[model samples]
Target: MTSLRHNMAYLLTITILIVSVGRLGDTTGRRRLLLIGILLFTLACILCGLAPTLWTLIAARALQGLGAAIMMALTMAFVGETVPRARIGSAMGLLGTMSAIGTALGPSLGGALITGFGWPAIFLVNAPLGVLTFALAYRNLPADSSGEKTDRAGFDIAGTLLLALTLSAYALAMTIGHGRFGPLNVALLLAAAVGTGLFVFVEARTASPLIRLAAFRNPVMSASLAMNALVSTVMMATLVVAPFYLSRALGLDQALVGIVMSIGPVISTLSGVPAGRLVDRLGAPFVIIVGLAAMAAGSIALTVFPGIAGYVAAIAILTPGYQLFQAANNTTVMMDVRPQQRGVISGMLNLSRNLGLITGASVMGAVFALASAASDIAMARPEAVASGMRTTFAVAAALIAAALAIAAQTYRRRRAADPR
Candidate 1:
């Protein structure tokens, strides 16, 4: 429960702080914010390592997430400003590859460190890396002139808080709804509704709203956001379900399971740069179609054969699809928005992804639970859980197919209108 709290603290805060932090970066200067964030993150890691209690660790983790959110939002925004408009896709693609490599390495490295030198090693190692990143950014990153001036509308404090409440409530509702529907869950959902209403009212009046209401007006941009959310649903579900299916259903040990699980991110890493290049050359819409098809195919493959070979192959196919879709999607969103709106758009991108994660956790959990209850394998049994996995994969495949169809229609509509 303690570890869960710590992890949840990190996850929840990332979504909450990302938008405001991202917008703050845009106005305050990305470099300065990035450096401050690194400092805070490094300090928070040390605090997490030395914390005397679970609550202390959780607090530190939340701070760490804030720092991470600041950096992540700015990083994308920064890349947009640094690169040429024509090459942004390629640049973002390289960034995505590096991100994939880190994601692929983190679990394995953390496990090894924890086993060898205790858990403190995990946090301690980041200190030096953080310092190096700080140094690099200070020396090499472009100077920002926006440091002195502030947005004319000023920070919408009430709006920011309300938006955070809205996001927090939604996350809590999904999380609590996982096990059972209780008073707390209902209250959370109510809070979410009230928070959203308050946020809309606040944004309507605020000069510098956290999110511009007009951003959703573009059909392509709106669909891109929705596509990101749904695609992330598939990604998160696969990550959550595949391991259990491998370890329990296939009877693989932790080591072997980890190996199999590594396949997707590994493929993602290798494919990320190439996928980005493809996005640059082929356009995001074309690459997205290809990616969606691959993703749906992989999910269907998992449904057909949940064995070791099939599992790895499914991940391998799905990985590049994920890489392709994500890289292209980021490029598309950034390209769709104006330069000044980059930071906020990136924030929205992260928000959409995280919402998908929370949603996937709740929806997939419910689906699996219900499927397990209805399966012939018997409830509370491993086979029953595996039965749930089978059902979820099929469901995921169908969802991806629907997304594919939507993307196709949108792209076709655009092409027909433009003839380009």
Candidate 2:
């Protein structure tokens, strides 16, 4: 539970704080806020390194999450300001590459650090990196305009609080049961639904809403967001279900399992820049179809083929597809956003991905358990684990197909309207 909380603290904070901080960046200055966030993150790393109790560490992690929220919210937004319109896809791809590199290296690197210098080293290592990042950003990032100050309407305090509470409730609802839905989860979910309704009502009336409700009316943006969430959910199944198949069905040892699992991230890291370049050359709309098709194929492969070779092949196809989708999807949203609205839009993009991940972890895990007919997954038979993996991925394939359908419909509508 302590370990889970440590992880959840960071995610929870990011989910709740990202949009608010992103809006703040738009009102204040993205560069200025980003600098402060880097400093806060660096300081929090040290606090986590020296924490005396588990709760203290969790608290520090949450603080670190706040810093991350600010940085992530603004990073993609910065691309719009700095990068040329034609190369936005490349920039988004570069971001995806960096993120994939971190994901790929984090586990192995952390294990090595812990072996050499204990668990604290994992947190402490980021201090120097954070400082270096801050220095680079401060030296190079563009300064905010004189007109960037907040207007008389100011920040929406009520909306921010309501949204935060609502998100927190939803996150807890998804996470609290350890994949078992109970009364508390149901109640929290209900609270979240009510909170969302209230938030919408308040935003409709407020002169300066946290999120402009009208934004959802844009079919391109709306459909893109939905596709992003669906794709993300399916992508997460790779992480949740593959391990059991590898370990129980194929009988790979822990070390071998780690190595095999690294395949996706490694592919993701390598493919990101190339994928972005493809988006630039072929256009985002075309690349979206290609990416979704690849994902659907990979998901189906997981169901049809067995053993580690099949697993590797599926991941090889799937990861690059993910990279392509991410670059194209981000570019589609950020390319033409109003300069003032970039930060909030970036936050919305990240929020969709995060929510998708959370839902995937809980709901997909449940599906696997149910399909396997296992009371306790860790103790389940090898055949059961394999069965579960197949069923889960079959569901994942369906999800990708749904996303693909959405993309196809979106494009058909676009062509019909424009006829260009």
Candidate 3:
């Protein structure tokens, strides 16, 4: 129940908030929304920390997701609005680096808190940070939502419903496939397929879709969003599975595993700034291709070499690529859209990435379960689990390759359309 709540609640809340913030873009000022989001998120975190019941915890998490969505959507739009186009890439890179640092720190911090105190400590620690963020936002953020005439299009209620159904079905399938559910797993998978079909149908007909179908008409934006999904999936899979491999297969202690996992984010943080500079100079497409290629190489290397040494090496190789790809992708997406529509575009990009993470986690968990059941594979036999990890990486690589192909096609189409 906890697992279900955590996964579904986070996914649903994030998706809803993204769509809501996008719709509210024209109605509310960006800075105002951002500040409000920060406050809501902080409050939600506090609620999560204090909640005594499972349902309460889920509700808190949902609220946190909403707040996070608001902040994220506006942050992207805010950057696009305030920063010069020429320097947007650099700004995005720096933002990516900060994100990498936070991600890198989270596991270690959470673990430490859990070990030192308990599970609740993990949620509780957010309070101080939330306060700090709120203070910063209140003081620094401007009050600017002024722009062109608002898009008076009606809300895409059908699209939103379909999207929620699709995500819920996918999450249910993953949990069931992982053996968390019994006979209901197959039903969940069927539901996912149905929901996805409905989503496609809704998207095709919606006059003002939650996800702007026409924006995808731009090859660059489409390819970037697609590749973002693929790369994000691979990255998430690696993060989820790596610690288990280290602790069970390699005979490493949990503390050591935590340290090893931190390496990737550290590398990512270091690489992000430079990648941003590169994007500014070379263009988003070029940077994205290079980043994707590097990530692919890293993933392939992990598949080939699944031991502790190999894992560390993979982190070294992949982290920078991941950071580069993220920074470049954000720049690409922001540049592709107009300022007024930045909120919606940002929400879409985030939605794609979050969806990818959910998919990867669910699929990879099932892979692990199957592999474990087939063999006497304890976490101690890292090589035994290596096969499963390898499969996951290989699949990720394939996805990245597909993304690369799409990106190439997008570049060609854009060049053909505008010779500027």
Number of the predicted model whose TM-score against the real structure is largest: 2
- lDDT string for model 2 (1-420, tens) is 887888899999999989888888888888899999999999999999999999999999999999999999999999999999899999989999999999999999999999999999999999999999999999999999756566425778899999999999998998888779999999999999999999999999988888888889999899888999899888878888888888888899999999999989999999999999998999998899899999999999999888888999988888898999999999999998888888888999999898888889888999999988999998889999999999999999999999999999988998899887
Off by over 4 Å in 1: 147-153, 177-179, 374-382
Clashing pairs in 2: none
Q: Write the per-residue lDDT of candidate 1 for residues 198-248, one digit (tens) a residue.
A: 888888888888788877777778878888889888888887777667766
Better of 2 and 3 by TM-score: 2
Candidate 3 achieves a global lDDT of 0.77
Please give the range of 10 consecutive residues that has the lowest summed lDDT in model 1: 372-381
Error of 1 at 306 (Å): 3.6
Instruction: Evaluate all candidate structures by whole-model CA lDDT and list the values in order.
Output: 0.83, 0.91, 0.77
Model 1 residue 264 CA deviation (Å) reads 1.4
TM-score list, all predictions:
0.94, 0.98, 0.89
The local distance difference test score of model 2 is: 0.91
Q: Residue 142 of candidate 2: its Cα lDDT? A: 96
